[model samples]
Target: MSNEIINIIADRPFNEAVQDKYFERVEAQLTEVFARPRLRSFAKSGGVLAGRAAETIDASVVGPSLVVFEERLSEDDKQDALDSQAFAEAVVNKLPAETSQEQRYMAYNEALSAIGWVTESYTYKKYDSKKLTLTMNDALLQVLETVISAGSGNVLSLVAAGFDKLKGDKEALKIVDAGSKESSVVSFKAVPCIVAPGGGMAMVMGGLDVFSKDYDGDFLFFTFKTEGVHLFQAAGIRKFNKRAFDRKRQQVYNYIDQFGDGLFKKIAG
Candidate 1:
């Protein structure tokens, strides 16, 4: 059987949840300073960049504990997980009073809190008896997916670099095409763009998780652009700042930082 999965879209103005200007500034600076070297390294070494894995979830126990996984998920089996969360209740209650910008903010927060709650509570338990593996080509696709998911730099830069590498190598293309059959690909559709060298872009499908996790119990297929893939990271930070900062300068800084990290993490990851 397949492992269950849940999707969560976070609250807007995400930085506001942990409001600190200095934290914002430092984060931006770190991202900018690191981005170029990271991209160069990725290009030189191929696209298998490393990222600092987020604090690990204790998968060891969860991996084997079907009993525990079942018990934890019993309630979720019946309802839309967010519907039962306190955050969702609060957001719904606040909806009628959402007259001011601040109230709208609260509503947004409530929604995000609900999402986080569901994602954290939900678990994907991989049974040892149901083990799966990807071939080298499939493994490479998973690596591409991971780079896109955790990367902290510009989407265009990453996409451009990633593409350049892939296009230059027949081996990479073979891996990507074969891997796509075994897993859910980060589905990206083409979009028009004027800024990209090739005058086009691509968007990830099924959202970021397309790159964030393994798919089909075997391979993982990450999204990339033949041209405008770098925009993905930029777009993420831009979305965060659009709702987070009241100040325009702060918003701009956040965009740069967020975009930079997207690229940085990809190469570094």
Candidate 2:
């Protein structure tokens, strides 16, 4: 899936815009759901089910076995997670296990818990192939977006291209963190695309962020989310007729190039 984050900053009071209500409701709902004991427990299990794949290939071995780790979201004695409860009830009704409802629920819950993990942050480094790589998942970007949205200031998304991910040089961090500079081949732009009567647009476009780094074995490529700087309504052109299709699409690609270059300069410099 394309990794991107679109931020919306309304010129007028939020109450006057569609997303004002949507985000307000969602923020409230998230606050409530996130605070619930059951939901908190689920969140501790990485917010949702996840998986990983890393297998060794050998001619001698008939097949490769994947090492997988999964976490189970537990229900609080007094509170229940909507999704977890539904999943448990469905498994129980199917009679998959020859056990009581409670036992079945527990068993299925435990079983699914073994699927994988949801992470607040994670890092991947591999050096066996022609390229070395380091990548961060959407969860991390989401947090960054939250920080950016809550504040009213200039936020810079830096990309480090053609660098060493495994480098231990202490100064490397400072170099990448330097203030912004001008760029010709690359730039970053944010565009507002969708606006709803009540809800924020479902989709938004962001300037692409790109970076390349060196790993243990080879070169690594990194892509980060840079959704348009502002958020808008997400109505479709065919039905809702919000904006010109050509205009929106062009804005997206241009911003992507600009942002991509901005980040690239930081890394390459």
Candidate 3:
């Protein structure tokens, strides 16, 4: 899929004018998302939610398993995480002795409650590999049309030459907090040194940011977000149109999150 996109963008004019600009725009948003204060808080409290992977403490969330923080606990709340064994026993008593399954689940809930979980909203997430392939092909097809004119012929030497142009963007890179580079490639791009738009664009940027890092030496990747978009839009590349496509796709994912199983039935129908 990526190789095909690369071939289309490999047109010299498009490479010089189109590719780096898209990467720069995406990178900017990723940098912004990664830099949020809450991320630092998450790192500082890194010991949290690590051990709950196997437990289903609450049906408030419907995932097979995922541990997410609802909120932060106050100091007194932290201190009050007392005698979980005792609380677990109390939970065991509250259920019928024959209902071992219910008792065990309730005990887990007691443990979670002793911690600082103060909220109860959930967004269920799922991914379809086949759908993902279709989506990628569709996105790439549009990108090719944007770069290649109707009669523009035989400019083929596999033009989408990766992100070799990223070196230019790196010269101006304002890297901050050298020590905070995230081990996770995705999280690293959305770090605070960049910007976030709080929507699908931000997500696309984050994903691209991770991609650049993951394939750093393999491609000419860069991220610029708003700056690159504005520059390219003014120059007639319509990079923002690509962003709109990404945003619209993201909105569909979000809709599915809210609709959950009902949406899945419609999708599979």
Which candidate order results from sorting by lDDT in descending order? 1, 2, 3
Candidate 3, residues 59-143, lDDT tens digits: the string is 1111111111112322222112211112222333334444533233334332222222211211111111222222221222223
Candidate with top lDDT is: 1
TM-score between candidate 1 and the true structure = 0.22
Q: Sorted on TM-score, highest at the top, how do the candidates line up?
A: 1, 2, 3
Q: Work out candidate 2's RMSD over C-alphas.
A: 22.6
Model 3 scores worst on lDDT over the 10 consecutive residues at: 230-239
User: Which scores higher on TM-score, 1 or 2?
Assistant: 1
Candidate 1 structure quality by residue, lDDT tens digits, 171-252? 3344334423433323221110111123211112111213332333222233222221211110111011212222333322
* TM-score list, all predictions: 0.22, 0.17, 0.16
- After TM-score superposition, what is the CA distance of residue 51 in candidate 1 from its true location, in Å? 32
For model 2 the local lDDT of residue 74 reads 17
Worst ten-residue run, lDDT, model 1? 59-68
Segments in model 3 whose C-alpha atoms lie over 4 Å from true places:
1-148, 151-170, 173-213, 216-269
Candidate 2 wrongly placed segments (more than 4 Å)? 1-134, 138-140, 143-200, 204-212, 215-269
Best by TM-score: 1
